[model samples]
Target: MSNIIEIKNITKEFKVLNRREGLKGSLKDLFSRDYKIVRAVDNISMNITQGEIVGYLGPNGAGKSTTIKMMTGILEPTSGEILVDGCIPYKNRTRNAQNIGVVFGQRTQLWWALPLVESFKILKDIYGVTDKDYKDMLELYQSLVDIEPLLHKPVRQMSLGQRTLSDILAAFLHNPKIVFLDEPTIGLDVSMKAKIRTLIHALNKEKNTTVILTTHDMGDVDALCRRIVIIDKGKMLYDNDIEHLKGFFGYYRTLKIRVSGSLSETAEKIAAEFPEFSVSANDEWISVLVDEAKSTVMDVLSQLQKTYKIRDMQLEEISTEEVIKKIYEEGVK
Candidate 1:
C-alpha cells in the first residue's frame, strides 16, 4: 500500500510570554517580547501507509497532540513538510478533510441533541457520502459491532462509551482514506475498551482506512497497533513494530517481592546492592526489573536472601508498559 501520510522534519514551535510574579510583571509581559519559544514538535519525520494502524505514544506534553494537529490541518507546522493523502494539510485543508476522518477524545463530532443516525446523516451530507456507501458502512458496523440499538438514541442520552462508539461510526461513515483517533478508548470500561479496539481494527481491515491512534493506554496499543511511534519532549524516540521494540528489553523481567520493612529504604538498599538493575518500591511490593543476562534470578535471590527477608516473590515477563517506561526514563539503551 502507498503511504497515506507523510511527515518530514516537522517542527512546531510556540512562543509563550515569560510572566512576571506580580501584576506589574503581568503588565510588562503584555507589551514585552521577552518570551520563550517552546518546541512542541521537533524535527520529527515518519510515514504511515494505507490500511495500517499505528500507535503514536508519549506522556502528556510529549508533542503527540501537536503532530496530530498539524496532520489534521488544525495547526500548521513551523517548518518541514506534512502531506496527507497527497495534499498539504494546512494548505488544502478542505480537500484533506474530504479524504480523512478524525475523532478526538471526549469531543463529540455529532450534534449534542441529535440522535446517532441524525449525526450520521449530517456527516453523510457534509462528506458527500453516497447512499450505497452509507448503507455499506452501516452494514459493516453491524457485522463488526452490535451498535444498531444505539443508533436511534440521542448523543446526549448516550453513555460515554456509546457516544464514543457513535462518533467512531460517524467518522467512518464517509469511508475516508485515513482516520486520526486521539485517545479513542479514554475513560472507558475494560469491556467497552475492548469493543472500541475491535471496532477500530475491523474498520481498518474492512475499509482499508489508515489509522493514527494516540493513546496512553498500553492495552489499546497492544490490541490495535502492529507498529508504534514514540516521542518525548518533542523528540522522536522509537518507531518500529511492537515485537522489535520489545526486543530491546527482551532479557529483562520484573521481580516483585513483599518486603517487611520500609519500601523506600529497602528499594534503596536493593539498588545499592545491584546497581545494574532498575529497582523501585511501592506500598505493596519492591519491584526489581532484572536483566537476567547479567545475573540469574536465583543468583540475585541468593544474594538478596543474605540481607533482606523476601516474604513473597513473583517473576513476570516484562510488559509493554514497563519497557516503554524504561525507554522514557532512560532513553533507548
Candidate 2:
C-alpha cells in the first residue's frame, strides 16, 4: 500500500507567557516581558499506509494532540513537513478537509439544537455531497450503527453514547479517504464502545479508509490497529507492528496453575526445568513467567500433570497498558 500520511521530522513549538509565583512576582509579570518556548511535538516522523489502521498513542502531555492538530491543519508545525494524501495539511486545509474526516470524542461537530438528520443535511450541503452519495454513505454507516432512531433526536437531548455515535457518522458522511479518530470511545459504556469498535472495523474493512487513532484505551488499539506508533515527551518512541512492540518489551506473560497439594516443590521443579521462567507458589496456586516462543502453556501443564494432579490452569497475556508503561519507563530501548 502507498503511504497516505507522511510526516518528516515535524516540530511544533508554542510560545507562552512565563508567569512568576507570589504576589510580588505576579505584579512583576504585569510589567515584565517573559516568555518560554514549549515544544509540544519535537522532531517526530512517521508514515501511515493507505488502508492501514495506525494507533497513535501517548500519555497525557505527550504531544499526541499537537501532532493530530498539525496533521488535520488545526495547527501549523514549527518546522519540517507533513503530507496527508498529496497536499500539506496546513497549506491546503480545504482540500485536506475534503479528503479526510475527524472525530474528537469530547467535542461534537453537530448543531446542539438541530435534529441529528438535520445536521447531516447541513453537512451534506456544506460538503456539496450528491444525494446519491449521501444515501450510499448513510446506508453503509446505518448497517454498522442504527442511526435511524437518532435521526430525529435533538443533539442536545441525546445520551453521551448516542451523541458520540452520531459524531462518528458525521465524520464518515463524506466518505473521506482518511480518518483521524481521537478518543472516539472515551466515556462510553462497554456495549457502546464495542458497537463503535465494530463500526470502525467495518468502515476500515469495507472502505479501506486510512485511520490514525489517538487514544489511551489499549483495547481500542488492539481491536482496531495492527501497527502502533507510540510517542513520549514529544518524540517518537516506538513505531512498529503491535506484535513487534510486544517483543521489544521481551516476552511478558503469566501462566497460573493449581495443584492438589505441596505447590512449593512443584514450583521449584518447574523453575529448575525452565530456568528462564520466574516461578512463585502460594498454597495450591502457582504462577510462572512464560515465553510462548520457548514453551507453550500446554507444554508446561503437560509436564506438571505428569506428577502432580492438575486442578486447574490459566494463561494470560501481558496487558497493552503494561506494554506501553514499559515503553515509557525504558524510553525506546
Candidate 3:
C-alpha cells in the first residue's frame, strides 16, 4: 500500500511568557519582555499507509495535539516536513483541506442553529461536491450513522452524542481519503460509542479511508486499530503492531483468588519467595501479580491449596492499559 501521510522529523515549539510575582508579575508580563521556549513536539517521524487505521496515543501535553495540528495545517512545525496525501499540509492549506477531514471532540464545527440536513447542504457547497456525489454520500452516511431522525432537528436542540455524530458525518461528506479524529468517542455513552466505532470501521473498509485516531479510550484502540504509535514526554516510545506491544509486557499476569479464610502470613511468605511476583490482599480476597514466564498461576495456587482451603481462583492476562501505564511510569531506560 502507498503511504498516505509522511511526517519527517517534525517538531513544534511555543514561546511562553515569563511572569515575575503578584501584581508586578501581571504588569511585567504585559511589558517586561522575557520568554521561554517550550518544545511541544520534539523531532518525530512516521509513515501512515493508505487505508490503515492507526491509533495515536499519548499522555496529556505529550505533543499528540501539536502533531495533529501540524498535520491538519492548523499549526506550522518549527522544523521538519509533514506531507498529507502527497501535499505539504501547511504550505498547501486549501488543497489539504479538500483532501482531508478533521473532527475535534471538544468543539463542534457545524452551524448551531441550522438543521442537520441544512448543515450538510452548506458543507456540500463549501466543498463543491457534485449533485450525484452529494446524494450518494448522503445516502451512505444516513445508513452508516442513521441520521434520518436527526436530519430535521436543529443542532442546538440535539444532544452531545447526536451533535458529535453529525460532526463526524460532516467531516466525511467530502469523501476525503484521509481523516483525523481526536477523541471522537470521548464522553459518549456505551451504545453511542459503539455506533461511532462501527461507523469508523465501515468507512475504512468501504471507502478505503486512512484514519489517524487520537484517543484516551483503550477500547477505541482495541476495537479500531491494528497498529499503534505511542508517545510520552514529547518523544515516541513505541510504534508497532498492537499485539507485539502487548506481548512485550505479557510476562506480567494477574491472579484473582478467593479464600475460605483470611490470607495468612504463610501465603504472604510463599508469594514473597517468588522474586518476580507482587501480592496485595483485601479481606478474604488476595490478588497476585506474577511473572508468568518465571512462575505460573498454578504454582501460586498449588502452594496456597497445600497450606489453606481454596474457595475459588481465576487468572487473567494483563490488560493493555496496565502495560502502557507501566511503560509511562518507568521510561525505557
- lDDT digits (tens) for residues 1-333 of candidate 3: 889999999888899987788997898688867889999888899999999999999888888998988998989999999989898888999999999999988688999999999998999999999999999988888778667899999989998888888888888889998999999999999999999899989988988999999998988998999999988877888889988877776577788787764577645865776556777776666778877777777887787778667687778788878777777787555
Best by lDDT: 1
Best by TM-score: 1
* Candidate 2 local Cα displacement, residue 178, angstroms: 1.6
Clashing pairs in 1: none
Local distance difference test scores for all models: 0.90, 0.89, 0.86
Q: Give a tens-digit lDDT track for model 1, residues 174-272.
A: 999999998999999999999999999989998889999999899999999999999999999999999888778657878888878888988999999
Q: Ranking by TM-score, best first?
A: 1, 3, 2
RMSD of each: 2.0, 4.1, 2.3
Tens-place lDDT per residue, model 2, 1-333, is 788999999999999889999999999999987889999999999888899999999989999999999999989999999999879999999999998989989899899999999999999998889999999998887787778999999999999999988998898888888999999999999999999999999989988999889998998998999999988889988888898877775777888898875678878878887797778888567998777778877787787788778788878788777789878777875
Residue pairs with clashing backbones, model 2: none
Residue range with the least summed lDDT across 10 consecutive positions in model 2: 243-252
**Rank by lDDT (best first):** 1, 2, 3
lDDT of 1 at 175: 91
